[model samples]
Target: MSANPQWDISKALMVARFFHLLCGARDACVTPFLTLYLRQMGLIAPWVGILMGTKHLIATTWAPICSFLAKNYQKRQLLLIGSLLGSAAAGLLLTLISPLDKALVYRFCNGSSSLMLPINTTLEKELAPNHSAGIKNFTIRTKRSQVNSRVMMGKGNPQRSMFETTDSSLPLLHVGSELKTPGTLVNLSLAERTRAQDRSLALSLGEHWLFLLSMMAVMFWELLSAPLGPAAADSLYEYLDFVDATDCYRRLWVWKLLGMSIGVCSVPVLVVQLDCFLAEDTPRAAVHFYGYTAFSILALPVCFAIPIPNFKRREPGHKAIKALSLIGNDCLLFLLAVTVFLTGATVANIENFLFWQMQDQGSSELSMGLSVTLSLVGEILLHPFKAKILKNLSSLGTLGLGLGCLSGQLLYYSLLWNWWAIFPAQIFGAISNGALWWAVDALVEDLVIPGTERSLSVMLRGLFYGNGASLGSFIGGFVVLHYSLAVLYKTHCVVLSLWLVLFIAIQSKLPQHRKINYSKLLAVDTADASDSEEGAERDWLIKAMRDEHLTGRAKNKY
Candidate 1:
């Protein structure tokens, strides 16, 4: 690569799109099947939960470190290294090993290799010729991929209205419009203008193709991984005695739910794809592992093909300080973190409790699968309306509504013993999980500075979902062991009620509009800006900071 490389954006995007698709394909083959893999290895309930939690814990721990490294090192180089290491780790899974040893290797590989996605996303943003155009392309492509995935899964076409909703929010080009140039238009021929338009259209089309490739990657992966979990659970059930099987299955689902929640909140790059080899049949396990390993190896060259512009390394000292200061200064962020944590715990508890409750009532694995599938469908259908919901209700109000829906679902579940009734309750699950998480995502974006979004996003995921799931899994497991699922539901309701009260209190105090005082927050030198307009902007910035607890030293820094 040239030292001063001016890459063709269209070609670069094509490479990126293909790379992401390969990544999605590889992960899809592995994650949802992990629980069954472990079961095949003869691991039981709490151990499953422990292993699942460990993976999240490792990933969460490594995310920040990786983020820092990506900033300072060549991103393409890091991608190459991560891909190679990941392939090696996948191959290692084929070997005979103790359960503990396998879990350790899996954690190391999963956590370290997971850096590729976030790094890739950041690299995409850096390389995009036009950020708004890229965002639009990404949204469109993701929607198309989602539709394709649903169709393949035998779900019918998604609502056409969803396309309209997504388009309305995205920035779109108005085609057939005349271009305004600085020079005299009379000097330019009609054919020249037409050529310009064609070039513009070509760029747009390239962006679309790029995004389509990325989404296809995700869609294909989802298709491969979706059925693996339920199938694995069924397989595991056959191996154990009835009582042990029920307990193991419940724990497996709980860990799976926790893993999903963490993956959603944490690293955009890291996905949860885990499967294990059969303990008794080493040969079969080797075959399964080798198949995935070969696929993973095939993905390596594709990683090298992605073209990311080199970035100069800056000392990351300011990163650490900025992160610490933001945490200390941002009270609302702290409260939101707490709210997400409690809310995650409540969701995890209720989901596990409800699933087992239905099963205990004689619901077959098929029925449980249908319930999960429908719930996922509901969530997907609700997603397009997320921006509108936030617009009308505000982030806090949307969250409140989601919490209310969750509360209602829990209440309904408590009152009914019938398994079928839970399906309708999934409407509540869909709204709460979908809308609430979206609200939180929006709120985080509004609260933080632009450069800090990735770190904050990872932090929130770890605090709210990662630690929350770990805590919930341990607590839920012990409670189920000692007490009844009914008891767990009752406790969940009370806890959420108390959390709602606290959330309301915090929401009341937050500024209705989330404007930050960058002058004070960033400590920009404004001494030269003595003009009235610049002075006024600086004054407004200071006041905004003051409202959020600006210190005397901070105020003077600018």
Candidate 2:
């Protein structure tokens, strides 16, 4: 894709909005429904679990690699566009994977027992001419069983005793005495049964193979596009610099929420309708696939129109070392890490258990999904005010408020008596998840070592959303198994309350400082950077080491 020649902020922002929305819609088209699609395709629970986990693992593994590539290269837009198109192409290939219909096209394709009904078999000499009709009925039953094999859940009858009639009631001459005389008729039927079973087994294996290959290819393409959200943030920052506009990086992500809300909220209803009309019991995943393909293709053009202004990038290793030093030196990083970890854990529990709790309170999945719309709207509402919040409370202060609000929400959940009660509680998402997100991003932006923007962004994204969520989910699974939602939520509320107090106590004890000059971190030369960011970092490092030494940890390392 070619970059647009006209690239004003107003024009670029519109393009950026469309790109983000399309990205969100594309994601909604496939990801959330993929497990259900697999189930409908006759995959069992264990296989579904493995496939979904594999997709997550791929995202976790490739995210950092993609970030590195984005950081090291120019023409990031080109990489972005390629990934978009590649994923679309991969999705389009799914149209070729519709369920296989016939099995016996092996003995004449070489061929069910009778339906095991009470119908009596007769000797060839005594049988009526209409015996062929009975055989035809058996063939119909066998084909119906084949249909069930592709049906959702796809459960089949358990094996029956040999006395049961097989559905392969064809070639009527030796129907009854064939067992006694094993002639050409019996051999043909037996061979047909064998071939049919083999064909069914082969088809099953092929579908599984196709699923594995399709998932891998799609995930591989997505790996290249993983840096998009972070890159968008970096681009926004650069644009702010270019236009001499005030930086409000925290608010920018509201667009993401808006787009995602539109996608996640609306698509499921359409998908339900599609599933109902397209196949009686089977889901129509082809729509999801082709829909994803279309959205990605649509976004490809938007990428060209969106401007991603580049700075004179710093040395890669130099930026990396800068990040390392910041981590080692800044106490704020520790606080940020622990907070985001807990935030991720809290989010995980909510995602995994909130709906379960709601269902127990008589909520439908429909209500559960619609409730998310309210939560997202709250988050978006809060995002724009982050600048004011940060101004009033500072990063740690804003974070403290977030923790307090989160605990409050948990308390409300503990007391929830009805499904509808969650609506009010979830509206507090603005203060809890949204505020915490903004606070964390604000601090990260403030602490960012200039040219390390994309690198740092991607790294922390993986930390909070990936590592923290993984650990949270692992722990939450056990917690939920033993405890009721009320008990679990109340316990979490207590824990968060303690955490908030500890956070405040530490914030008071730690050496606090004013915000660093943003421009200094962006310096192209080391000497220019050394004057401000380096000096501040040195002072902060000394304070941290002294503090750690007093605590008898890392005493000799410095």
Candidate 3:
């Protein structure tokens, strides 16, 4: 096969963008609304937590298996199978199951269906053409689709109440003209070049596995919610199969956010409409299930129709190494994980607790929905400014700002008894959560070694996020049960404040460093080390050695 393969830009973008729309719609119908639906069914806080936790536990367990399949199989086929199975499971819950059976089927279906996320992202990256102009054109068309979806969905309040947190990691958009190419070096035999490529592939696969294992270990506490968005995004970039990474990511985000908005906004409308037609509560859920089923059915044909280009998979010749061997030595990654874990905890706490609090204060469904919509609108409006903010403040600095805002929002909620107080609080929450997520995304990309699996970093982040959220939800159920709402908010504030302090302390000690070029490592060049002594490769090696020594010292001091 030639080094550079040709792709149909128009077809690829259309498929990926449309697929995102479907997935978004599916998520809107289910994930965010599940909690509200359960609450409506008269389940208390603890039962809600337990059900959500069960789903997370099952999803986390299935992740490694899904990752393995993704690495080895035809991703498009896996996505199709997952979508069909998930839809069927949802159908069973909708049409056939009693209340007792609902939770089990929901958990199973949610986990099984989620497997499609990473596969879809990987396909999008693989199929997108590598030209700036093509990507720009694709983004323009995708935005129009998003606008149309939102308009058709209807807009009284911003559809924010049913905010389902999807994975935020997608392809990194590279806008620069000077794309990096392989380093110029002496010519090698055809056999040597093939071996080099094979070795590179094996090393990457091993790194990804190692990261996966680490995430699973660290995220064992995660028992609610799965973070699949970033993982999919990371996979898209990792394979190095797609062109114009940045443009691809932009299109993915636009379509995804749009779809989610539509899904979330539709729920209140569905509930109100269903209440009139069907006396039993089951009918509302059935409608949701049928909606997902219809979307899943439509998705399969679209998946098959997408003209995805085929790439040959290479078999690795070496055994995979331990996860720790590749990343255990990196101190920055550890800190990043801790931060991600805390962020997840705080976000989950806010998400789970706030809704219940609103209901307790006698807020109507429309009012609560409007609050959520406004919050989401705040988040969306703030997103475009993220790049500018990050440019001015370091990732850590931005994180601190987010944490501070979150702390203030919690404090406000704790003090105020009025329902309308949540409006300004939503604005604060948006800036806080949005900024924190954006910083974490950029930090993960920056900290990862260029040649290794970027998806692993994302997965690891997801693990932390999931772990924190699960623990938070479990503990939150008890906290809200045992204590006042004021106490819950105060507790969150204290925890975040502590994390902020630790973060600042850690940031103060970290070194200001140059970018490490891992092109040699990525190339897997078989040539002797001496041949590559004249350029950035030599400098990179020296910096890596120095960093390793410093890391050893830091470990001893701790």
Candidate 4:
């Protein structure tokens, strides 16, 4: 146990916080604009689709590189160097457009930056601890188990929720029966599952790396910039030891490397190709491009101000807040899953709907870019309100508001035909995204110990995001290929509605810790205690050594 209970923010944390902020800003700048950039470069839609697919492939393996780097370099230094390298590459790419230059920059920024994913994961995991000694390790292990269990169950059912079917025993028998009864219908064994998983991961590696680099830079900047309260560090050291440096680094690397697989499989391809909706060199096209970037940039700082309860550090006034937050977390995750699914499908089908809208409006590529830019502008406009909403409402309330707005946006999209009408939806998207992201970060940070494990929490977040995005993208592609865009959009509306209902239903059951004096318990106040303990221990050791020396002299004289 640490002699002092309070946590002090370290230099590494400062480095990480700044990096995360940069990542968020970068994501806002890049992701929504990449497809249009591809169009600018004269790539056709099919190649664009291939590039979109490849982004996820790179994202999925991002963590392994972090792990490998951690083995040889200081984590903080590596992050700094990575960012510098990526930034330089991005700048160079803006000026230089040859295939070779694009490839090099893309590999440096997008390909290698995946390494940071695991580092972030480890940081989040290290942050969630209390005063109890060894509590963090135990909690991390438990959290891992729970996450694995949920994933396994999710994989097994594929059609049902884990909560719906409490029976875990039936899947094995069902699998076994399938194996016995059929040739083509046979269930896969563990070996086959591993093989399939490997193949899926392997398939993502070959897409255009440059575009992925842009998106990766943007997202990572967002993550790096979000603020870290003192509670994060205090809680982390309470449970984890950094002394066994190799083990510490290794543990941090494990999930992130694995998490990259999640990213490679997650990006929504249709979203990347949204530029096809307009002809080249028009105001609307520029609007689309700028609007997306603007929204992302505005969303990050606003999200930092949103106040979700830190359930990990118990507060005094909000006794029931913890319980409410737990229910809220579950609800939020459910909604988020649905949101990802629907959004992905909509993005995939957007080209279908926009093709007509573009024809009707005679929208050019510049117009299309402008439309994207306008959406981003609208999103930017709404970012400021996020802090206020979070502070005044319960965490769940804030989430509900965001989701409600998001639902309205979807409905608006469904009812309207004008490309200009998308402004309202984009504005709402900014708020929705800010609030939703803050809610998730707060929820996870609350659940875990704060210090060293905070990174793990972040990593897990990436995992969930990567998983949802990959699956959503994959499903969206199939839906667009087979169904009309209208069908896809309407289907998304239905999923969002279902998500809301599930959140309402399941929100009462999860565990929550009321607001407590978490800061008091965390190691913030350790200045006095640590000094006193060290002084006393040093004095005692010195006296003991003196007594031993005196005894040796007396015995020799006799």
Candidate 5:
């Protein structure tokens, strides 16, 4: 790596943190407020729910659109444009009318912001340290996770089965398909396979000018982010999966996603309850509560940083680094999945509730601000745990526990109409989010995607999550618009039940193994007897074991 004093390690870390914060604040400011704004315009709860869900629906629609651009245009430039579009959406919200106008603007913003996924993931990879990308993934994911939870409100749910928060659409990106040589096939034919391809495009004068304008817009927003907010976590899952022959990155993602997705669906019911409770009283109290929670979550990244493994230099032959990076990458995927769902839900829930409340009472702007602040605080509580809890539990076990808590939280909150009841449910924010941060990053590292492909894998993993969130949000809105609160709650519970089943199924397949040889220091410390004496031998043995566990090697190589 080349040394540039202007771009030191600390600076890079700071930039990554800043980027995460920007996304968080923008998400937080919009979701809750968008809902509130709609209600003020005379839309009913059903309409508000539908409108809010549109955010995710639009995001899903745009994932492929943004992915196409990402492959064809300068990713950074596309992201800048996305940011501007998001700002335009916010600006448009100030002038509201029929639900249709609101929906159109919301969808546009959702799709535009969807472009951020690939660019954001790419930037995180760029800022990461070469050998200790695990730490980098952990740190970036944690920071972003917390921001997402705090601002977005916490994960949402369609059946209203988890902790309630605001919701937003998760962005998606497509990276052609799995890497492959020209013509190899086992189960599927070439026509059946989806190839992950990259195509380069020429930059024209018009494109360059548009890029410049977008950059300026992003800078404007970055300056205004302070005094505002939005964010989760899971990271060690990859290590456990690697050891467990049946647990691959894809399967673990399915389970973690199930838990997180259920949470995403729950936000609106909680919002309605909160809105009704505050209808007869002061709504500002709720906002203050949200604010307090958001500020609290900002402390989490520092907390997790204390326990993460660090590598000061590259590993010899990059073997240890490769393994660690793979684990971290897979874990990152899991964490991103959880956080994205939480954020999307939180943003959606807050918006739905705020719209219902504000429309009903003609509440002051201050009260609305306070409500958003309270949601942000809830997310803050969630940020720290992304990496901390994984120190003990397997990815599935941790997620299972989190989902169980979420189910209980939803049912408990649904029974009580009091505002106080909302607080107890919000507690799930920390546990579910923490697991996301710790478990997913570990998965990424354990997967050990090569540097050349790291950016694509991370983006695609993000797409899976973003796409799921979009669908979940849309369905949640559909349920809200068509069903009673009871129906909504019951539906949420059912979805969560299904999510639990999927999680269990995936968990059942997880492979178990002993810990990796962490006896080495500085990537692959030669001073350590383990690294020098047995590193290669152990590496071969581990590979042989995994190969046998996977498909049973037909022939063995020395």
Candidate 6:
């Protein structure tokens, strides 16, 4: 291939969009479902948590090392493509592992969800869009919007929504729109309880061995996938600069949100269509893993096509050292790290296990899909206003706002009764997930010791998203095991509340010299900048990444 080869901006954007879309879809297919998928394998809550926590732990630790090695060699083409293919192969291998496809304890658990059927199903004429079941599925609502749960919680049948579709005059109910009572193992017969205990005992015999084995498998999977995030970010900036699209770079990431919704929504469709063609006992959830593989493989080809300009760069070790040096000098640095860590812990809770909780509430796959779509929509709608938000909330306050939103979302989730109500609550994600990321990214950009901009970003993200998420998932999993999902989410709200107070206290006490220049980075996310403001911010961004001789010291404060 020729060096400095040109790609048309339209062509580059199309390729870039496709790349992100497919990757987002690939990740979405498995992410919201993975913990529940593990649960379907007869492992309880803590084991699932351990596996996920370890996965994040490995991914985070390995990521900075991957970046360090890449900078040393300065060749990402081979590594990026290899990671994608390897991650895809790992997912495929996961699907290939048997008995996990079916929720086999003693017999196949058929389904593991407990979504409530709409209250007026008999009076209704059509099922909600989320429900695709046509195969004579019978659910009797005890109250309007309450699901007639035949199976216990966490035993929702995937096939009911996938294979049982009909045009009959049966009123379509939104399953788990309301719960008649808080769900538990209370309603089972003595004999049924005995059988459940027997199954539990049997599962316990092999639980430890299996947990270790699954943990290893997932750690291996994440090892291949973790570095891709930073690599993708790097490639994104490079591609944008090549196409002269840096001015609109932040908004361009909206494609990722769009793609994630598509991927999540696609799962129910795939499960339904595949069930029509597959066998009686085929594992329906396998569609998630296999579908993810397909998208990842599709994205592999697009990786080669992205016009990320290849260029020589220096080793990032000294830069990393400079970034780390700030920890000692900056008093408020601890507070920032704490906030990011807590944020990561809470976010990992929501993304990793929220659907699993909803499933326990008798939620359907279709409803979960809608939940994800709405959450992403909220993020897309709310993220662009970051500049305005910063202008009003100021640095500390914006960070607090993000944490507040996360806490509120967790609070809402803990009290979740009507599954339909969960849709509106996801608006909290706009601030918690999207605006929070923007605020942190911008703060890192502003607060770093000048030339160590990129290094500091990677370092802090590794701390929070890697270690913080891992720690939170580990603890949160046990919480779900001992208490309930509701209790765990409520606990998250409490933890966030305390963290927020601690954060504000520390930030308020910080001297002016220790604060970061948040105003300078306000334009970090604004694509709608006027002509005068746009030129300065764009140049600063471009030069920040490229300039080796950056002309600033510990001048910027947060």
Q: What digit string (tens of lDDT, one per residue) describes model 1 on residues 1-558?
A: 343265444444444444444444444334433433443333323443454444444444544444444445645345454644454463453344333223222212222222111121011121223433433334333444454344434534233233323321122211111222223123435574454445445544644453344333323333332232222222233223222333333223323343333322222122223332235334223333444455457656755554444435344546545655676677777777777787767765564445445533444334544565566567767767877999999888888887788777777777765768778887888888877777777877787776676456546665456677657755764555455455666677777777888878866765554646464555865566556876767674556666666543443453
Alpha-carbon shift of residue 4 in model 1 (angstroms) = 8.5
lDDT of 4 at 375: 48
For candidate 1, give the lDDT of residue 396.
81
N/CA/C clash count, model 4 = 117
Using lDDT as the measure, the top candidate is 6
Question: TM-score for every candidate vs. truth?
Answer: 0.53, 0.62, 0.65, 0.43, 0.47, 0.74
Cα lDDT tens digits, model 2, 411-503, are 887777777988988777668886786777777877654555555555556655566655655555444434444666677788778878887
TM-score of 3: 0.65
Off by over 4 Å in 5: 1-23, 45-50, 60-82, 93-388, 448-461, 509-558
Worst 10 residues of 5 by lDDT: 194-203
lDDT of each: 0.49, 0.56, 0.54, 0.39, 0.37, 0.64
lDDT of 4 by residue, 1-558 (tens): 243234233433333344334433334344544544443333323444444444443454454344323323424333434433443343333323322112222211211222111221011112122222132223233333354456546457332233233221110101122222324233446675454444333322322453455445434532232212112222233223332222332233223222222222222222333432233222122333343334334334433422212223322333224433433444344444444444443444343234333322233333444455454444445556656766787567766666666666556655656546654566666666556655555554444434423343433344444444445445544443354334545676677667767776666553333322245446454454435666766554454556656755653554
Model 1 TM-score is 0.53
Flag the better candidate by TM-score, 1 or 6: 6
For candidate 2, which ten residues in a row score worst on lDDT?
Answer: 102-111
**Where does candidate 1 stray beyond 4 Å?**
1-33, 36-42, 75-298, 315-321, 344-380, 407-426, 509-513, 516-558
> Can you write out model 6's per-residue Cα lDDT over 373-461, one digit (the tens) per residue?
98888888886687898888766678778889888988998887766778878888776777677777667665664446556766677
Each prediction's total of clashing residue pairs, residues at least 3 apart in sequence or on different chains, is: 5, 16, 8, 117, 107, 32
Instruction: Flag regions of model 4 displaced more than 4 Å.
Output: 1-30, 36-53, 63-68, 75-361, 364-384, 414-416, 445-457, 511-515, 520-558
RMSDs, each prediction?
Answer: 27.7, 13.8, 24.0, 23.5, 22.0, 11.0
Candidates, ranked, TM-score = 6, 3, 2, 1, 5, 4
- Order of all candidates by lDDT, from best down to worst? 6, 2, 3, 1, 4, 5
**What value does the lDDT take at residue 170 in candidate 4?**
11
Report the Cα lDDT for residue 386, model 3: 89
Model 1 pairs whose backbones collide: 31-273, 31-274, 34-274, 34-275, 37-276
Candidate 4 deviates by what RMSD? 23.5
Error of 6 at 364 (Å): 0.9
TM-score head-to-head 3 vs 4, winner: 3
